[model samples]
Target: MASLNRIWGLIVKELLALLKDPRARVVLIAPPLVQLLVFGYAATFDVNDVRVGVLNRDGGELSRRLVAGFSGAPAFHVTRHLDQIRQARPLLGDKKVDMVLHIGPDFGAHLHRGRAARAQVLVDGRNSNTAAIISQYAGSIVAAFNREALGNGGDAELAIRAWFNPNLVSRWFIVPGLVGVLTLVVTTLVTALSVAREREAGTFNQLLVTPLRPPEILLGKALPAIFIGLAEASVIVAFAVFWFGVPLAGDLRLLYLGLLLFMLSTVGMGLLISSLCATQQQALLGAFLYIVPAIILSGFATPIANMPETVQDLTLLDPLRYCLVVVRGVFLKDLPLELLLPQLWPMALIGLVTLSAAGALFRSRLG
Candidate 1:
């Protein structure tokens, strides 16, 4: 009972120390909100309003209809019409257009005889991902034109349907992942700084002289960060659903449960880093060093399946990876508890291992 009381008091002190400072309050609230807004709006995979130029050598009715098709797409904007093939060079080189659609003089000739017609699209490949998306959009436009002109005679029509995010909005994918990412950043930083801050302020020795055991002290440090992390995650989740229009398709209870395990893992990692560092600067640096790789490996921006086999194996240990699956699954798929168990157990195991390691390290430091 006394041990619990001591730990409870320490938790209160830690929370107050974090919340009492004006700058700390701002740091805790402002950056995550700002990052959420920035990443939500700015970072996206969906390409829109692509600038394009047209170079038409074939003065045929079919070619004109093809140009009209490009003009009508919401994703594309016809910025320039080139009289010569050479004109496309300057436009593409000057970055004035993403792609130049060239209609060959033989385009109408081949179509009239039921032969295959090829239209060249000179795309700026500087941004490979964007270029690929643009190519797909352009190809889709061409395919539509063929269907209209040929009356379904050219090729078999392909019906593509996107599930979950029917419109395939990139924000739907990004914002949910931000909940895990931003939460990890805040939780890790808060706990990573706790011990270092105490050592820097010359108060760590004062705690050591008290009756509190190492586990109690660690619990005191961890609980505050877990609370703060969950709070931060809640804020992001609210914004993701309410402000960003991302649907909350899963059970809120399941989402929070996953978040709790995720917070435990992150706080444990942070505490471990905190115990090793002698100063706040080292702690901050160390936290980021772990965070950067964790986020990369978490399948946040990139798919884990695309990674090399060795790297994929390495990601098994990243708690953020499992948390992302839980967050995104819950937000988009209405993931049931059974489906989430694989993701959940990994994080719980990681939390258990990291927390035990942190406790042992803290005791060794005390000795």
Candidate 2:
């Protein structure tokens, strides 16, 4: 009963320490929410409202029809129509448009004569991903035009269908993963700073002399951080669903279950960092160092499959990598328990290892 009272007192002290400062209170709540809003819109793969210029030497009906198609495309906005190839040079040079569509004089004649009509597309290659997407948009538009012109009589069509995200909205893919990323960041920062701050403030020895045991003290530090992390996760998840309209297709239980495991691992990681650092500055630096690489390797911004085989192999130990797949799966795919177990078990293992290591380090430092 005395130990239970001691644990309660420690927990209250930790919470009060976190809440008493107005700036810390605001810092704890505001940045994660703001980042969620900013990244949801800013980090995206879908390109729209692309500026395009058309130079049509063929003034015939077919040329006008082709130009009409460009104007009608949702991904493109026709910024200007040029009379000469030289006119496009100025537009391209001035960066007024991202792409130029040049239709030759023989474009209509070649089509009427049953010959393959040719057109040229000049694109800004500054951003390779954007360029690739634009190229695909142009190719699809051209292919569609050819099919419409050919009357769809005998040509085989590739019927492409996307599952999970039918419209292929990057937000659907990105926002779900933000739950993992943001939660991990906040949890790591809080837990990593806890022990370091206590030591720096000369409270570590004071706390050690109290009735609370080391395990109880560690629990006191960890429980508050876990609660805060879970709360942050809830906030981000709500924004993703309510504000952004990203669908939640799976069981809420499973989503929370995955979050619990992921948060545990993050809390363990944070505590491990905290036990290692003597000051808060070192803890902050250590957390930042871990976060940047963790996010990169987690397949948050890019596919893990694209990495070198050895790099991919290294990501196996990253809890966020598995957590991302779990979060995204729950949001978009309605992934079953059997599928999620693979991710959940790894996080559990990571949490156990990290938390145990942190406890050992904490004892050593105190000794």
Candidate 3:
């Protein structure tokens, strides 16, 4: 009973110490909420409002109609009308225009003769993904125009459907992932600096004089960060669902289960970093070093399948990688326990190993 009381008092003390400062309270709460709003609205995959150039050598009615199609597309704005094809080359090179549609002199003749009309599209390949999306948008416009011109009463139409995110809004994908990342940034930094801050303030000896064992001390330090992490995560999740309209299709119980396990892994990793550092500056640097690579390899911004085979193999060790899959799956797909077990086991194993290692290190340091 006395040991339980001691652990409870230690936890309360750590929590009070962390929340006592006004700056610390703001730091803990504000950044994650701001990043949630900013990244959700701004970080997008849909390439809209692109500049396009038109070179109409034909200057015929059909050519004008096609030019109007490009101009009317929501994805494109026809910014320049070139008299000569040669004029577009300079704009393309300067990136003043993302694409140029060149209508041939014989384009109307080919259309009237029932021959396939041809248009050349020159795209800037600086950003290949954006260039490809531009091509698709242009192709869609041309295809719709062709269907209208032919009056295809019997032509088979293909209807494309997207699952999970039907509208393919990047917000639906990015906002949930930000929950894991923001929680990671906040929790890791808070826990990573916990030990170092105590040491720097000359409170290490004071802590040692207490009857609290090393594991109890570690728990007192680690639990508060985990609690703060969960609070930050809850705020992000609320904004994602209510403000951004990203639905939480999964069981709330399972989603919280994943969040708990994921935070355990993060807390353990942070404690390990804190145990190795002598000062708060080193702790901050250490957290950055771990976080940047973790975010990259976690397949948040890019698909892991697109990475090299060896790099894909390396991602298996990243707790963030699995946590992202869990959070996204729960948000979009309502993944079942059987489906999530593979990720959960790895996180549990990593938490146990890292926390055990950190506890031993702290004990040795105190000894």
Q: Which candidate is the best by lDDT?
A: 1
Candidate 3 lDDT, tens digit per residue, 291-331?
Answer: 76677777677555445566678778788888887888788
**Per-residue C-alpha lDDT of model 2 across residues 81-189, encoded as one tens digit per residue:** 8888677655653347767888888878777766677778776442335555777887788777777764423221222223355555778877888999999999999
Q: Look at candidate 2 and tell me the lDDT of residue 110.
A: 76
Q: For model 3, what is the alpha-carbon lDDT of residue 238?
A: 96
lDDT of 2: 0.78
Flag the better candidate by TM-score, 1 or 3: 1
Ranking by lDDT: 1, 2, 3
* Model 3 spans with C-alpha error above 4 angstroms: 1-158
Ranking by TM-score: 1, 2, 3
**Predictions: Cα RMSD each:** 15.2, 15.4, 15.0
The ten-residue window of minimal lDDT in model 1 covers 154-163
Superposed by TM-score, candidate 1 places the C-alpha of residue 225 at a distance from the truth, in angstroms, of 0.3
| Model 1 ranges off by over 4 Å | 1-153
- Model 1 agreement with the true structure over 1-367: per-residue lDDT tens digits: 9999999999999999989978567657865665564344434567776788888888798888888898999978899989988887657644577778888887777777667777887765433455567778977988888778675244312233233555667788788989999989999999999999998888998886889999999999999999898888889998998899988988999999999999999999999999988789778977876787788778777545445566778789999999988988788777789878989999999999999999998898776
lDDT of 1 at 353: 92
Error of 3 at 35 (Å): 22
> How close is every model to the real structure, measured as TM-score?
0.62, 0.61, 0.60
Candidate 1 lands at a TM-score of 0.62
Error of 2 at 289 (Å): 0.6
Model 1 clashes, total count: 0
